[model samples]
Structure formats: C-alpha cells, structure tokens
Target: MRETLPILRLLSLALLAGVSLLSSVALAQEEDGLDIGEAPVIIPADPADAGTLQPSPSNPAGATPEVDGDALELDRRVRDSQPPVMKGGKISPDGEADQGINIYLRMGTPLPELPPERPFADEPDDAYGAFQRGLFLTAVDKAMPRAQLGDPAAQTLLAEIMSRGLGVKRDPKGAAFWYGQAAQGGDPAGMFKYALILMEGQVVERDKKKADDYMRRAAEAGNASAQFNWAQILVSENPGVRGLTMAMPFYEKAAEQGIADAQYALAQVYSALKDVPKEKKDRAREWMHRAARAGFDTAQLDMGLWLVNGYNGPRDYELGFRWLSIAAKRGNVVAQNRLAHLYINALGTSPNPVEAAKWYVLSRRAGLKDVGLEDFYLGLTEEQQKQAIDQANRFRRG
Candidate 1:
C-alpha cells in the first residue's frame, strides 16, 4: 500500500504539469488568436529588393514563440473581409474630416511619392514655348537675355510680361520702356502697345501727337487695331469728305479683318452722311449686317430696325425678328421693346400676347417708357397676365 501511494503521487504531479502547460498554451492562443505551434519566421524585403523577403524589424528571434497579436488581429480582420473602417477619424456631413485625429491612418506605413517639378526655360524659343504652355516664369527667364540684346519680339514679349505681371512682378514703366524699344525696332505690335501707353499717360508721359504718330506707323504696318484707332484719330478733327477720304482706306482695311467696331463705324459713316449715293447706303447695310452677325448688340438692334422698315434693304420681318430676339436675349432694352412689338403683331412669328407682355414688362422694369406696350399689356386676360408675370419673375431670378 505504501509503494502504490508513491506511484500515485508521481502520476498526480505529472498530470498537473501537463494540465499547466496546456492552460498556458490556451491562454496564449486566447490572447493572440494565432496557431498553438511556433510561428514561422518572416523576413521583410529591402526597399530596393525586387522580390526577396527578410526579417521584419518588429519581430525578432526568441521574443515570443507566438505570432504578433496586432498582426494576427489585422489578418483576422482581413480574412473576415469586412469593409475597411475610416481609420483615425470620421468624415462629417460637410465633407470635412474629424479635427481631433488624422484620417490618413488607413494610408498604411509609407506615404506616396510627390509629383515631379515643373520644367524651367533654357533658351529663347523655350521661353516662348513655356509662355504658350502658361509657364510664365520660364518665359521671362528665356526672353530676358534676348530682350536685353534688342530683339524686337523678345522686347515685346517682355513688355507684355511686365504689363500683365505674367510669372513676375508688374512694372508698367518697364513695360513702356520695353514697348518703346520694340517700337523703335519697327515691331507693329510694339508700336500699337506703345501708342496706348503714350495715350494713357499713366505709365509714361501723355503725348497724344506722339501716340497718333505711333498709331499711324502701326496702321501703315498693317495692324488691325492700329488701323482702326488711326482712322478715328484722323477723323476726330474733321468728319467731312476730306477726313473720310483719309480714313476710309484704313477703316476698310480694319473692317476686312473682322473688327466688329470698325464694321459698325463704317456702317454709321455710310448711313449718316447726307446725300450719300444708293450704293453707299447699300454698303452701309451690308457692313451693319456683318457687325450684327458678330454679336454687336447695337448693330443687331440697328440692323433689325432697318430690315423691318425696308430702309437700306427690303423689308424682311423674319430676319428682323431673329436679330431683335438675339439682341433682346443679350439684355438690350431697345431690342426687348422691338421684340415685344414684333411678337404682339405676329410680324415674323405667331402672335403670343403672353410673350409680348412678358418682354414689355421686362423692358418697362428697365425704365423704358413705351405707351403702346403698356396698352397691349393692359389688354391681356387675367390668366395671360399671370403667366407673363410668372415668366418675368423667372427671368428676373435668372
């Protein structure tokens, strides 16, 4: 009995040791939620490595036989395939992130690389290329040398840059100087710019005569804007035949270049001159139509009225209505009044009293006093008036 008792005591101790080991292992697994066996060693890859793996700095030999708890948790979360939570913070309804925390935690360990730097200009042509590409600083760098060397195009470009402060500080005086230099070099654009500077008198001295001279030079050089301005200068003192004859050629040159203002001016000249020939009036109508088509609101209104009244051309109500409608849409009050007239009379389109009332009210609101339009509006039924009021409200809101 004594021998059997000893053997039982040893068996009890052995069982206790086995149970203790198992409890320890179970506790570890509960904490880590990893395998019971020793975790396989993991190596992190070098930054430059193509595919080789090496040991992670966080995990080392003999630290723990179990997998890392955080790593295991991350793995489990990944394996469960749940939608990723917005790490570190939440996004508010206003499209802002929570101010208390960094919302970029989900971006992992490393940040993305930055974008490449913008290229700088290396040469004169490169400067122009950069300027064309909107790299104004690069343009200035490349053109500075050439401008200093008296290159007219480069000087003009620098002048533009200084005037507009493109990729540099604004210097109107410097721009004027550069423009003067370019003009002296016989650059037409430079002459035009310098003429404006001279006229403004803010950057340089006010010299209208010098400005006129430069403008004339620019006009002679075939600059469209210069030609228009020069013609105006010549005729400012004299609107008689001699002045007209002097300016006519320049005006024609500018008009042929698609200058809307010049076209309108030419039309006015032909139409207003007393005792002008029928051919001149016809040319006036043609020029007015050209300006109208170019979206000049005044020209549109004049052309519309002329066409409707059979002045300078045959009466074409349809064409008149189109021009008036275009001008009205551009908020020309005169055009709106005319359009309302056309609408009420069904001249070119079906008569719509509601539309006419709407336009009449709009024009009246803009301080246009039209007795006929007021009478027409007063004649509309209550429902039609209400609809017109609603349309006016929409138009006003817009």
Candidate 2:
C-alpha cells in the first residue's frame, strides 16, 4: 500500500515506542546516510500471539505496561496529538510564536540517524544476510552469538527482531535490553533507539536525564535527526538569544544535510532575529525557498506570499502563483485562499471568475472566509455559481 502522511506519522510514533527502530533506520538510509544492513521489519497486520504478550513481574513499578495492542493504541493517540495540518495554517503541532519570533516552521522531535556502517559489515553475512532474506529465525540464531559477543550491529538486529516478533514471540523488554547494550557499545542508532525507550518508560524505566544524555551522544556522533531534535530542546529550554545562538550550528548542520524541517527552522530563526543585516534577513527567504522546493507545505505557502508581496526581493507574481498553486493542490487552506485572490485579480494569469469562485469555495469550506470573495460569489449569475460549485466539488473529490 502507498504510504500516506497519516501512516508515516503513526510509523514515526511507533519508532518513538522503540518497536520500530529498524523502520527509522530505513528512513535515515533514504536520506543518503550510512547504511545499516537492510532489515525493513514490516508490522504484521495480525501479529501472531499479540494478545499473549504481557508485562513480566520484573517490570518497574509505575512504569507503563506494554501490551502489544495497548502500545499500538497509545502510539496512535500520541500521533493524533500531532495531527498533520490538512487545513490548519500552523506548520506543526508544537509550532507557536514566542518573543515575536515565528517558530512554527520546525516540526516535532527528530528521530535518530543511521549509525555509521558497522565494523563487522563483511563478517556478519550469515546473520544480516539471513535477516535480509526473510529467514528471521535463522537470522536470530546467527545473530545471537555475535550479539552476546558485543557486536553493536548484531545487538541492534536482535532488538529489531524481538521488538517486532519476527519469527519469534514479541519481547519488548528483551528488545529494550538489547538496544541498551547496543547503545553502550557505541552505536549511534542504538543510542537513539534506546533513548526513546527510556523516555517513553515502557519496558524500561523512564529516565529523562539518561534519555537526554543518549540523545546528545547520538547528535554529537553526527545523527542529523538527533541534531535537529537536540537543537529544538536547547532552544526550548533556553529561549534567550544565547540559547538560540547555541542551537544555530546544530540547525545549520541538519539543514546542510537536507533536512527540510531544519531548513524551515533556520529560515524562521534568521528572519526573526532582531538587528540582523538586510542580507542576513534575505537569507531566510533563501532557506525558505529551499524548504518549499523540498515539499514543506508551510514553507511553500510562505515562499509564495513572499514572492507575491516582494517581502525580501522583487515581486514575481507569476512565480508566486505557481508556488501557491502547488500548495493549494496539497490542501493548504491559506494557499487556496491566496490562489483565489490571484485568479480574481489576474495577477499572474487572466482573470477567471469561475476558477476564482471554485478556489474561494474550497478555501471557505476549509474555514477561511474572505468577505470580498463571498460578495463576489453572491454577485455571480446563477449559471456561473452552479458551474463554480461543480468545479469546487470536483476539486474536493480529487
């Protein structure tokens, strides 16, 4: 099945739950980073014995128990809190303005980056090769010895298998143990995974301090996602200029690595910093454009507006219309509203009342009401109004 934004969000939360570390590793690979040998653990639709897994007597008191179904549901609720802004203008769930700085560009906390290639890359053929080929039981058998011998890769692979119940019973506690070992063995990915487990307090005791330390280690070890997240933490805890200054380099590093959210965050930071030179402020537009081109809908909306209004450069109505159209098609209410205005005013193209009315209706349905657009719609002839509504319905269906 094709992956949707909602599905990806759920998967991300699952990563936070420490049950899908391999999936997170695979995502890092897509960013052209280090390769952890392929082990894309698919979440089974009906995991075998999912109902039978229960917390052991050894579980820490007051720690959340991890029943397979309950864990999945809890992950879903966590994901729902950070819903994708299908119609809302906000960039992310956590985004908000503070001290006159617009910090809505950064998304949620970052996940771990893929650790550097394991030193035993060539030697682990039996275990990794078997895991990659779907022989989960065989892979586990081969990996166990190396894992016991303190191989980070082997330990991580075992963690992945145990967490997902691949050819074995699901064992989140066992997964947590292996992940901790892998982290201690100097694996950046393991540090990230183990950190998340510690933070969640499921299967392992909650230790916010320990989690922060592990996250810092992962970030310093060159995990781009970790760098972005750690930067966010630092900025949040220290909202002063000094704090932002400290976070800047990490954001820059992550942005340089092609993290679009990081690029958006940097753009906001540069744009909002007081007393910055004009050239420096203009750099915000550059990063915004980069992020927009990389598929960040919020940046696309901002870029379109900036281009249309000549905020940081000469006005380019045609280019602005293009960007606005791209975001509008992606269901951005603000973009749709702006696209309607552009159509009505013939800013980039010939005025088309029908198209304008269609966009206005769509935007209005998404909770953006423009009085002028409403008046214009009311003045349209009955036939034109009917045609506009039909077009709006078609767009809605698409």
TM-score of each: 0.63, 0.63
Candidate 1, run of 10 with poorest lDDT: 46-55
Per-residue lDDT tens digits for candidate 1, residues 1-398, read: 00011112332233223222332242233322111121111111110101111111111112221222221111111111222234334656665556544434454545557699888553236655566656666667766666666666666777776777665556777778878877876777788778878876886778878888898998898777777667766665444555665676777788887766567667766665555577776798899899888777767877776666655667787897888888888877777887888888787779999999988888899888788789889888999999998998787321
Cα distance off (Å), candidate 1, residue 64: 79
CA displacement after TM-score superposition, residue 153 of candidate 1 (Å)? 2.0
Question: When superposed on Cα atoms, how far off is each prediction in RMSD?
Answer: 38.2, 18.7
What stretches of model 1 exceed 4 Å from their correct place? 1-130, 240-242, 274-281, 396-398
lDDT of each: 0.63, 0.63
Pairs of residues clashing in candidate 1: 43-54, 43-55, 44-54, 44-55
Model 2 agreement with the true structure over 111-215: per-residue lDDT tens digits: 456689747433235776676656777777777766666677677777777777776767787788878877877666667668778867867888979988987
